[model samples]
Target: MSLYSALYSGVSGLTAYSSALSAISDNITNVNTVGYKGTSTEFSTLVTESQTFARYSAGGVRAIPRTLVSRQGLLQSSSSPTDLSIDGAGFFVVRNSPSATAEGAVQFTRAGSFRPDAEGYLRNTSGNYLLGFPLQVDGSVTNTGNVTDLVPIRITELTGTAEATENIRIRANLQSSDPLIPSVVAGTYDVTNAANNVATGGVVPNFSRDIEVFDAQGGTHTLSVSFVKTATPNRWAVEVYAKPASDITTGAGLTAGQISRGTIAFNSDGSLDVANTTPALLDPLNIAWTNGASSSQISLNLGSDSNVDGLTQFDSVSTVISTSVDGAVFGNVTGVSIDRSGVVTTLFDNGLTRDVFKLPVATFQNPDGLTRLQGNAYGVSDFSGRYALVDAGTGGGGTISPSTLEASTVDLAAEFTNLITTQRAFSASTKVITTVDEILAELNQVI
Candidate 1:
């Protein structure tokens, strides 16, 4: 009976050590695998009955394999723009299907070696697509924590629509010492009048600047702002012309491809005095296009009425400090990149950038409790609890490191050490079986 027990114990030891060897082998094999987590074999004892003074019992061993999923892997620099890694806790959300609306199972992974397919869908080597929340034009996430709201990040479009110019902000200094233009009657100021031209025996403007504006069809047109000093102190007639005053000979009212005039009055301290000037002149000026393009309403922002945040009449040479207009021509998407906050920005050929999507990282209450799936991915289990999907670098989610990858967590030296110990234990267990068999054979011969 003792020999039979000894044989069973040796078999159990062999089985347990074999399982341990298998775990070690797996760890060593995946040393070069990206984002691979190692596994370890845990042993448990089996007992038949409680020990008593008159009786003795032997116990066998059982092996239980456990995955080291919570350990962090080293981050290595990568050349791809989409390659990403997490320095802290969290996993990149992914899906098996390529369709954005496909009702496929969601998975999580640490492998970040990603490349875009022909459809511009980012997928890893395992063929799982990266999932994220859609972004509005203002760079805000559409959905916060809902998993179902996540969609595949696709950038199939090659170009972005052109936008019309709406607002033009100009900051400049109008020389206060410049001579005033000869003033006619206040109501007789006509931009088309030949007398308005300073080049041909007419009143000369002290300063002028040219700006290009885009229409609804992205047609470019020149807008010229001329400042004429008036008889009133600290007041100047601001005239905007599409063509030079010398080119208009009809002396007719302003027409298409002509000019519009407004008046600006400044305070003694060089601040804008909107109360005394016509509000129509300070409002948005509509420009009619001769090229059949839609008329554009351009807001001329010189400065605030009571503040000197824009145009200033200083006692210096007239100079344009800065000018900015909000409009863009039709452009093709030239490239894409991700930031630390996981915003995927698409760069266009027209020097315009857009935030297309916000990549959200998913974290679990107990990451180690997750069930390991194929291709270095994990699935949610009952013990793992629910996943909390949050934007990257927010709500405890780790910041995404673009152009990097997570290396395997397996240590080759440690795995080799474990492999040697497991092999010795397996050999010792076989010896126990062999010795027990010899004793049993001798006892049978005597009988």
Candidate 2:
């Protein structure tokens, strides 16, 4: 019986020690594996009586070891535009929904090896869609409270297309006592003597201008505007006409119906005061020209408003003030820049511009607790907690680079060392079995 008890004790030791050695070996093998954490065994005696004092044999094996948490490794940067890596905290959310369901298909990961999917969505290498709020140009995410489904990155050519038209604003002071019947003249006015015609009761002798605007089909339209001295210095007439092409000869002929006319007036002080009558043909026509596609020319004659009582004197006026017709045409996209707040602005090819969108980032509570899916990604789980939304360059999340990537984290030397230890431990366990066999043989001989 004593021999049997000794044999059982040896067997237990051999089995427990062998299991411990296996745990160590596993740790060593995976030491070099990315995102892998090493593990060790914890041995607890079996439930049984000790045979040394009462002749009863000890029974049962010890406890086994398991891996608990994987340590967060250092992040290596590849600087690739698509490669993203977290520096301080938070895990990237991923979805493995083969059917792309809203709630059920979910996972998470720390790896940033992401690419575009079939639908042009930013997905991981494993075809898993990444989860996050859509980044806007302003570096702020839209509807940040809600989480977006797995999707691939959609990168359109940052290049955008644009068209532009310029509305030339012209304001001129025409004198009230010139023999001109019209207050405003819009057309090629063959000014007999523009240099000497400078007259006024507050009206300049002559003022003329030409503006360019784009048609619906992107064709260029030219508008000719002119202000001539009428019969009265304080009452000058206005005229407007449209030419389809840059060369006045190539443009459509201006008809009386297509023509616009108005009047300009002045005060006793010789300073020009402008007001147009309600029936002025150019007032409505100019509105249509600036707002309409084909009708290019528009003229407004500002007749004088008579309520004057102050020391209003005028000497030589060079600039005219325009109260109506305020609009512009964009050229094309030429430049792009983002501010710290994430506001995206685009300069047009024609010197025109506008704001596009805003961009933002997200954070999680227990990033390590996230569930890993395919393609080095992770999804939110009960353990991982909720997402904390933030703008780009805010908190710990860094700004996104236009062209960059992130590398992996693995240790090779540590794995090899663990492998040797496991090998020796395995050999020692085998010797224990052999030694027990020899003891049994000796006991038989003694018997």
Candidate 3:
């Protein structure tokens, strides 16, 4: 009976060693796989009860394959900007289809060799589509902690964009030595129309400057701000009007291309005096574009109170210095970039960047317990706890390394050493099987 048990034990040894060899073979083959986790076979003894020490029951061996999914892999630079990697814990949530919303279809992976597909959806080589939270125009993301809230990151819809000018600041020196012209009204100056600007029969401004501003439609328009010395000391009447006169429909209190008319007062020290400045700086000037654009508002910012940073008045010759305006013309989408926090920003040729989506990193209680799936992905199992979606580099999640990929966890030297040991063990198991066979054959002959 003991001999019979020994024979069965030898068979178990052969099976266990075969399993170990298989695992080693796979490890050696997948040494270069991106985001690959190596699996190893662990052996355990299966013992049987024996009534007495003299009568010993041979024990068998069992092999268990364990995938080291949690072990981090080395990060390497990648040529593709969409290629992403996590430096620490968690995986990238992905799906099979861009339109998939089912919770069962959700999967997780560390393989970040992603690129935009034909439809502009980001997908990895494994055929799994990358999912992310859609960013609103205000740069806010609303996540319900559910897979349905995630969508495929498609960039093709963002073909082109235009930004309207909202704020403008002018910096220049107004001639303080210019004498107050009696012909120009002192207390209040009304620009009958922009035609008063020409040298013929109209009043010529002492100084004038032109600035370009972008409209809602990305159309460029030039605005001229003309200044005239007034009867009041240290005060000048200013009028802001658009060029070509026909570009904008005239509104009330606006004529001759004038959008706004106000008087600027300067302190005796050559600094701006805001309290005495009429019409207040930063007030929205509403205008209707004749070029079929919607009504838009533009805010003007003169300098701070008693600050010469903007609209300075000095004895120097008057000249237009510089202008700072926020806007961009219509532009084509150039490319996309991802920040360390996993925010995907769409870049345009007009030097504008818009946040498109935010990639979420998923974490689990037992990452090693995940079930291996196709495309270098993993599925949630009972052993692995429920997944939680977290912003990259937040809530203890791993920081996203843009334009990089994670190297496989396998080590060639180590795998080769394991391969040799497994081969030897497997050979020894064959010897055990053959010896048991010989013993059985002897018994058969004796019987």
lDDT of every predicted structure (CA atoms): 0.81, 0.48, 0.85
C-alpha lDDT of residue 126 in model 3 = 88
Better of 2 and 3 by lDDT: 3
Q: Which order, best to worst by TM-score?
A: 3, 1, 2
What shift in Å separates residue 142 of candidate 1 from its native position after superposition?
3.6
Candidate 3 clashing pairs, residues 3+ apart or interchain: 193-256, 194-256
Candidate 1 lDDT over residue span 1-447, tens digit each: 556777898999999999999899999999988889999889999876745667655678999999878889999999989899997889999988866455568999999988889888889998888988888767777656887788887865545656679998999989888865545445444445656553223555778888887777766666777787776788887767665333323124653334556678899998888887757667787666656677678898888886778888889999999999998877777778999988988888877778888888899888999999877899999989999987788877899999999999998999999999999999999999999999999999997
C-alpha root-mean-square deviation, candidate 1: 4.1
How displaced is residue 379 in candidate 3, in Å?
0.6
Which candidate, 1 or 3, would have the higher lDDT against the true structure? Answer: 3
Error of 1 at 200 (Å): 14
lDDT of 2 by residue, 125-223 (tens): 666655544455444445444444323233332445334342333444433333442323433232222222221122243555555555433445555
How far in Å is the alpha carbon of 132 misplaced in model 3?
0.9
Q: Best TM-score goes to which candidate? A: 3
RMSD of each: 4.1, 9.8, 2.4
Misplaced by over 4 Å in model 3 are: 101-104, 179-190, 193-201, 280-282
lDDT of 2 at 96: 62
Off by over 4 Å in 1: 50-57, 100-103, 144-146, 180-189, 192-204, 243-254, 258-260, 269-271, 287-296, 305-309
